[model samples]
Target chain A: MITLHDIGFSYGNNHVLHDITTDFHPGEIVGIIGPSGAGKTTLLRILLGELTPTQGRINNSSSANIAVGYVPQLDSGERTFPLTVEEMVLLGAAAFSRKKPWFDQSEKREASRILERLGILQLRNNRLSELSGGQFQRALIARALMSRPSLLLLDEPTSGIDLHTRQQVLDLVHELQTDGFTIILTTHDLNWVAAQLPRILCLNGTVTGDGAPSEVLTSQVVRETYGANMDVIFHQGRPVVVDSVNNGGNQ
Target chain B: MSYFTDPFQYDFFSRALIVSVLIGALAGAIGPFVLVRRMAYIGQGMSQSILGGVALGVVWGLDLYFGAAVAAGLSAALIYFVRNRGVPVDTAIGIVASTLFAIGVAVVSSSRDRRLNSANLLFGNVLGVDTEDIILVALVTVIAAIVLFRNYKTLLAVTHNSAVAAAHGVRARLMEVIFSALLAMVVVTALRVLGVLLVAATLLIPAATATMTFRTFRNITIASICLGTSFAIIGLFLSFHRNIASGPAIVLVGATVFAMNMLTSTTSQRNRA
Candidate 1:
């Protein structure tokens, strides 16, 4: 379990996060939803220990030296980088073994296993530029899993993919959650987060709402966080969000 | 043919050949990092700045190589410092490079020393290389190879993505500084054969050509070394036969190879598609 208490962060004179307190238990799958400039990435960076809060403390119940895995946003430059999928995954293992410059057999085995688990083992020898959007996301996830991290944080995992690919990625996330791995992801897709994640944190520079999807994703809270009117409805016992502009008859 | 074998008969030609091979290999080895990290222009900046240092050394009756090394190191550090201040890297490099180059020109123009031949420094005369210069180049090359080999993985991580590397416990900033210093040393040592103007070409063209032809980092690096050395030898022979300046000949040979590689790779890619 990881707990953040009264977390506040300021860059120079501009405060980004303020007086936030939250606790994340093991095996929890949480989605952080917000508009642009909502400090979602900033919050993730702080949790990854890349940035320190100016006015808060964190408590971790896990043992010392907990490994945190992160899949950053896709960079266009990474497409041109001359690394095969296997080599990219091997970089994760390389980070742990600082003393050995070469990856041992066991490390290679681990990378292969992770690629297999991610259903991308066939692409292990393919260059990154050759992978499609969905395959590329899977490769990045495999790279993150190579560390066998206790906590996994993914930033915008389904941003540029098609709807079918998005659903497949969400299904993969569900499978990972079933394996008792704690996962936190940030996304702007409100409907997807509403339907997929067990818990949602609605953030607009601070934690505006935090609870189960049904309880926290009310029309008023969605409006407050996104600054746009959205209609929330229940279909087959699951909540679905429709944007006001696109809601033909839901209004 | 005697065209190539005749130059090998002279001791100076043999020595110059050896030095060219060594410098070419060093530049080739360091080229990938420069291209991968987008520091190709930094080589231009540091090499050009070496002129100011050379001029300063001449005015003070010091070893010109020493002055060039110090000046290049300072310029590299200044570029690093400016980048940290939120200035875009290319702008910082451009500002520092032009300023230092102007200073070097001013110093040369005002100096009354007759022995300091600016033309020789700008366009190198590889035939005039001495044994001491060859020794210095060899020592620097060995040291650079060892450092790069020892930190190969860390440096790769940093070059690919610095933020991710930092998150994984690698000291990206320290590696960057050390790499910059090493690059400065390379530029300074290479000035003897490639000269200030063309040194950046030696550092850039080989890696770029390799990148066009290869798909893996290791293969690209190996290809770069081979191409660099080949260009050096071919350029030496061409210069010896045609009575052209050695530095321009080497760079022209490299440019030719780059163009040829570009053409072949594009055609192959089209064929694959």
Candidate 2:
């Protein structure tokens, strides 16, 4: 379990996150939903220890060493970086072994296994530029898994892909969560988050609402967070979100 | 061919060939990082700033290479410092490089030394290379090879995405500084053979060509080294036979290779489409 207490961050005089307190348990999937500039990426950076909060305390209860794996947003620059899928995945393992400058055969086998697990084994030798959006996402997931982290963080994994690919990626994340990996992902797709994720945290520079989708994803809460009117409907006991203006009329 | 063997008849020609090959390989190995990191302009800035150091050395009666190394290193450090202070990289590099280059020109104009040939310094004379220059180039080549070989993965990580690398416990700032310093060393060492006007081309063209022809980093690195060394040898041959300046000849050969690579890659990409 990891706990964040009163996490507040600022860049110079502009405060980004304020009084953010959250606890992440083992084997749970959490979705962070917010509009742009709501500090979603900033909060993820703080969790990954890339940025230190101005006022906060974090406690990790796991006895073993805590290793966190991060998957950043899709970067077009990395696609043309002249590295094969296998070599890119091996970079994740490089972070683990400090003494070995190059990956050994054992690390190669591990990378192959992760690629297999991610269902991209056939693309091991293919360059990153050759992979489609869905395949690239899978490859990035395999790279993150190379570290064997207890916590996995993904930032906007389904932003640019098609609807079918988005559903496939969400299914993969669900499978990982079922396999006992704690996952936290940020997204603006509230409908997908409500339908696929177990818990959602609505954020606008702070935690506006946090609970199961049915309890926290109300129309008023979403409007407060996103500054846009959204309609919330319960479809078979699960909240289904829709844009109020685009779907004909207000609720 | 007798054309190739004719240049090897003279000891000076052989030494110039050896120095060119060494510097070519070293610059080729280091060039990809500069290209991938989008620091090609920084390489240009460092090379141009070396003129200031050489001019200062001429005025003070000191070793010009040492002066160049100091000036280039200081400019690199200043660029790094300014980048951290929220200045954009291209703007900072421009400000520093032009200032140093202007100072170098001013110092050269005021100097009383009759033997300080600015044209020869700006455009290299391969035949003027001595044994000491060869040794220095060889030493720097070996050191650069070792440093790049040992830190290949770390450097790749930082180049790919610095924020992600930092998240994974890699010190991105330290790696940036180390790479900048290495770039400075290469620029300073390469000045004797390629000169300020052409060294940046030597550092960028081969790497750019390799990127067009290869799909993997290791292949790109190897291909860049081969291409750079070949251009150096061929350029030296042309210089010896055609009575042309060596630095321009080398840059021209590299440019031709880059054009060929671009043409072929475009055709292949069209075929794939």
Candidate 3:
């Protein structure tokens, strides 16, 4: 279990997260939904130990020794580097070495296995500069899973992908959950989060509400986290978040 | 023609040639990491900072390479410390290195009568390379190259993504510190022939030139080494024949080769498109 007790964070003088008390249990995919600049990334960073809380403690699983795998939204692909997909995925196992250089045969086998599992073994030799948005997202997730960490923290894994691939990525997360991995993700797709995630954390600086998606995604919480005049509609057996101010669109 | 009878007939020229090749190999092999890590600017900054150390060592009658190494190390540490202190690294490098470099210029200008030759340090008289120094350069370069080749994948991971590397259990910060130290070592050794002002070019130009044409990491490294060594040999010849400065001549040749590579790659890319 991951527990944050009285967690507070500040940048210089601006208090970003104030007294956040929450518990994230294992074998569950928890989705954090919030507006921009609402400390979602900061909360992830705190859990990943990139940023320490100013006034609280975090309790992780006692036996969880491996570092938390992170899927950053931004990648070095935006820069010009002729790295291949297999090369990129191999980076996930880079930390598995202690000394004496080079990865042995077993490590190489494990990396190839991950590539096969992700259904991208055919694209192993393809350069990362050539992958499509959805393909890149899948590759990033595969890279994250290479470490076999207990907790997977993703930051907007579906930000720029098409809807179909987004569902596939979420399905992949659910499958990993079935394999007993805990996924803590932040996404702008609240409807998908509402539909797929068992537990939802509505956040604005602090946790506004926390429960099952149907119970916590109330009209007041939606408007407070998102903007004003937002409507929550249940259509086609799914909760669709509509911002009427934006003229019947999610934006 | 008698001088061409046997290339190693003159021990000085042989030492210079061997040292140049070894230094070129060193720079070529390690340079892509510098290019990829976005530490090219910092390498330039550190090389310039070596001028101050060289000047001080000359004035005090101390070992020049030792002085240069210390100064470069201190400058690198200072850059990291300033960054850790919330100051931007480039700004700190600009402030600290430029001030120190300026001080070196002032000292060199005022102490013309102290029997210290600043021009020799700037342009580099490769004819003065002795057997001991050449052997030292070769040994250091070989060792460094071996380490780099052995740990190529781990270092690549660190360069690609420090966060992911750290997550996968790589000691990212420790690896970074080791990289910086090795860079300082490489720069100091390279300054033996290229001199303080032009050493960074020895490291950067050939790697960048190869990058314009090559897509694979391994091929880029090999091409850079070949180009760097070729430039050094040609530059040495041009300096000897025309009685010009070796350092400037080498850099000019490197710059020309780089421009040509850039032109060919751009035109080829356009044609493909």
Q: Which one wins on DockQ?
A: 2
Ranking by DockQ: 2, 3, 1
* lDDT measured at residue B153 in model 2 versus the true structure, 0 to 100: 78
Q: Which residue runs of candidate 1 sit more than 4 Å off their true CA positions?
A: A98-102, A244-251, B84-86, B112-115, B271-273
Per-residue lDDT, model 1, residue B130, is 85
A55-149: candidate 3 lDDT, tens digit per residue: 89988767655358888885644335666777677678776654444566786687788888877888877777778777787778777887778
DockQ values, each candidate: 0.46, 0.55, 0.49
Candidate 2 per-residue lDDT over residues A1-251, each given as its tens digit: 99999999999999999999999999999999999999999999999988899998888897776787788999899888888999888877655555435788888999999899888999999999999999999988887888777789999998999999999899999999998999999998888889888899899999999999989988889878887788888999999877685654433
Candidate lDDT (C-alpha), each: 0.84, 0.86, 0.78
lDDT of 3 at A135: 77
Q: How closely does chain A match the true chain A in each prediction, as TM-score? A: 0.94, 0.94, 0.91
Lowest summed lDDT over 10 consecutive residues: which window, candidate 2 chain A? A93-102
Model 3 lDDT at residue B93: 86
lDDT of 1 at B203: 85
The top-ranked prediction according to lDDT is: 2
Q: Give lDDT tens digits, candidate 1, residues B33-74.
A: 899877778899889988888888889989878999889888
* Candidate 3, B74-112: lDDT as tens digits: 788777788888788889888778876786777788776
DockQ, model 1, C-alpha based:
0.46
| Model 3 residue B235 distance off true place after TM-score fit, in angstroms | 3.7
